[model samples]
Target: MAHRFYVVSFGSLGTPDVVWAPVTDTAFQLDFEESLWCPKALINDVLTANRLRLRVASRHGWAWADGYGRAGVSTVRDRTPEETDLPARLIEGGARDGA
Candidate 1:
């Protein structure tokens, strides 16, 4: 198969209830893409809002979530622009301010 990477979306990315999938790979992983999300629509609005800020509530005591998954393809990695190089750059890591 092809290369793959996991996505943790905020706003409306894979926000449960399976609304929209602008960037279609599969129902396995999600992206940090604003275009691929709704930003204000979610199964539970509060959970959606919280996730948008990356506000995770871990069992370690900081983040929480209803569910999470891996994009079903092959593997998962960073596909960010500056963080990656290529014709392969199409799936480069998300743009980071540090770059």
Candidate 2:
């Protein structure tokens, strides 16, 4: 199957930003920390290994580890309703209308 360059942007888990390049783009590199580009095949390897759920965030897309994760997904108890509520001070304190 054909692969293309991918923007490996920041995930919430602190994965490094990179440009996953095709062999045609440059010689293959295994050292990720020293460079911003790596062979695109590396991405396929990682995604397969991690078994993450991937999805497009919007038309201009990004990936997350798991689409179904919500607050407290890993915890035994859900967060308190008060903990989840948006602070009234934030809303009242010079916040923009649409924001």
* Poorly placed runs, candidate 1 (over 4 Å): 9-25, 28-35, 41-99
Q: In lDDT terms, how accurate is model 1?
A: 0.28
Q: Return the lDDT, model 2, position 39.
A: 28
Residue range 1-99, candidate 1, lDDT tens digits: 333433333343334442222234453333333223334465445323223222221112121121233111123242321232321221232222222
Residue 80's lDDT within candidate 1 is 29
In TM-score terms, candidate 2 sits at 0.18
Measured against the true structure, the TM-scores of the candidates, in listed sequence, are 0.19, 0.18
CA displacement after TM-score superposition, residue 56 of candidate 2 (Å):
2.4
Q: What is the C-alpha lDDT of each candidate?
A: 0.28, 0.24
Which residue ranges in model 2 land beyond 4 Å of their true spot? 1-17, 22-51, 62-99
Pairs in steric clash, model 2: none
